[model samples]
Target: ADVDYWSGCLAPDKLAARITPATQALVAANANGHPAAWNELRTLASQHGLLLIEDSSEAIGSTYRGRVVGSFGDCAILDFTQPGPLSCSQGALVLTDDIDLASKLRLLRNRRLSDRGSVVAGGLPVADAGIGELNAALGLAQWTRLDDILARRKAVEAHYLKVIQSFEGIKPPYVAPDVDEVHWFLSLVHLGTRFSRGSRDDIVDDLHTAGVEAAAYCLPLHRQARYFDNQRPSQDLWVTDKLADRALALPFHAHLDAEEVEFIVQTAKDASINVGAGSAIYL
Candidate 1:
């Protein structure tokens, strides 16, 4: 909910404009495995004395300006969900250099209440919240093969990019010049402006009908039913809204081989063409 409240990428000037007496922290993501302007954000955060928190969940192996995604902020978080490179089945890891912050996080994760109902903890508690031995073992096994897994995923992404380049009205994901490595969790494509949200959805549905799993991924949080608040003025997230409407997430996984990628790309192209033709007819 906190993230939903302040979600879209704020420009340095826009961020400065939004600051007030109550603004104490700035939480940002290296959104969708592409590096954000973290150095600028860090400078802004420092200028305003606000803590910079990073969510590098989808960017475990990604880097910004030669430094890893999780290394820029005061504290950062990584998700080890099944979709991520380091799949622990279900868990997360927090990164921080501060010992005091680490101790506080330990307490938060494993708070033991005393008989009087006050929390008690000495050092890092051996709490139940910690990863189980079996899950730990599984995560370790996967971690050991991370290099090969990442390479496979990168290969799949490259194939998709190459195939997508030939298709009109669709573009591959953008990686900034500063982003040295991108461990893409999803092979996202952006439809041209001629494509509406309905057009994008139609293509996704067509892909589904053709046995290719694709989706109109990542709707803007402000537009979601739970996050919309009448009391608060709506943010002018024009770019966010546009991206939400056009972005399509194609099937992506390390296990997907060249043949599978070729089929998926072909299906996606066909779906886009069909949808684009239908839109023209309606016009």
Candidate 2:
């Protein structure tokens, strides 16, 4: 089972162009808390007789076309890990409508560890893929209060957006017409095309020096060592490459208040100036 890389968001046309005879599934992620175009992706997958797997790991509470993200696809997934809305420290979930598939998932999840008595939460064997009772309890606690959690997170998002206006070169976040709600996984900003990847790195370094946690965002898998493709330079992935070079991820969590958000944005603005792309120039 090999995977084919589609350059950016799972736009139906771009993804369809890459499907081969061997393609058996379509995995589309609601990235950065914003839901992808699930309606289009589902149609594309069905047209090709391929299964649709919704990756809602980064978009737990987000909605697309008035429906929650996890409700799309033949099967869907939600990850409970650090920084997620329903974070249980480390664990995930597989949700499916097909009873047969649900049974299969449950069986496979504990097949290797079922005999181990130490594996709790039923006599069932627990594998690395299975969440223990403790984590499950924690995730459930958060899950039951998901509405309040998402609401608080939305408050934080509002703070960031209010302050984002003062930060030059960064526009208001974009939401497609079809998307109903967005609960971002992180506070990400894109610097203008004037900045190089190295300059973006420098800004991150500057943030670190000032004791502000920040990071670069969306490094294309094709350019990394694990899946390095020298031919990527000649591919139709200019948007991907350009985005990888200029994107930045700032510290974001529900606990953050308006003042903290201002400081973080101001720190980024200063960092940009240090990298020669002044605040007035590019983000």
Candidate 3:
């Protein structure tokens, strides 16, 4: 399921090839604030008569073809977590126009007191997924100023971009042509081919040694311990694995000022140089 090295979204062709008689729904994410190929995905879903579940948790304000990410799929989900733009401590909101599906989802999440005896259950277990009143209030309050929140994060992104451009081997943010806007979930600096996974780790270690926090962007799902299976034939995801090895995530938040941004970038550059990867960048 891991697809591209760049935007980190699903590949429609790969997804389509994997579809079988048992395939129920198609899930896609506007990963790291970059919109997925919704047009292609929509067509694939329609052709297969499958439901599309859009994951807009990291891309709350990102837009694709002028339409917001959450506005694309049959139903979408928004998370109010710390990493997300809006945080209510913790909870998620699922969006759907289907009343029946909503009702089912609500039932699955939590059985209302009024519905316990009123409705019949087929031995379904309740997850107790109800959001507390305080959390709900907080989420609603933050929702009203969502635009301002996104704008502030965008400003931080600008700072990071401006700083990273001067650092050797790293390019600015990558945005697709069709994407109208991007609201980055994290400040990312992609290491080119000249740096190996170990060198990337060395860079991160150096940053940490300098009291700067940084991290590898992600470990692909298929490579994770839980999902790794030798019996199952490996799907080709060279790009995903390679990108996972190369991508670096730095401290990113609306609170970071220009000076802090410069320090972070400079630290990364110094780290890259220490690892013998600063000059010979694989552009």
Number of the predicted model whose TM-score against the real structure is largest = 3
Model 3, backbone clash pairs (residues 3+ apart or across chains), number: 0
Give the lowest summed-lDDT range of ten residues in model 1. Answer: 1-10
Please list all clashing residue pairs in model 2, or write none if there are none: 113-125, 114-125
Q: Give TM-scores for every candidate, taking all chains together and pairing residue i with residue i.
A: 0.86, 0.87, 0.92
lDDT for each residue of candidate 2 in 32-59, tens digit (9 for 90 to 100):
8878778888888888999999998899
Global lDDT of each model? 0.75, 0.79, 0.84
Off by over 4 Å in 1: 1-10, 112-129, 230-232, 278-283
lDDT of 3 at 177: 89
Clashing pairs in 3: none
Cα deviation in Å at residue 247, candidate 1? 0.8
Q: Tens digit of lDDT per residue, candidate 3, span 1-283?
A: 6576567889888899889999999999888899999999999999999999999998888988879878888899988887778999988988888898888788778877877677556566778797889999999998999999888888888888777878776655788888999998888778876898998998999999999989988887777766665544445877777778888999987788889999999988888887864356654
Q: Write the per-residue lDDT of candidate 1 for residues 1-283, one digit (tens) a residue.
A: 1221122344566567777999989878866676667888899999999988888988878888889888988899988885777888877778999898887887666554542376554655544576667888898898899888888888888888777776675644565666688788788877776789998999999999988889888877677776665444445666677777788988998888778888998888888887775332211
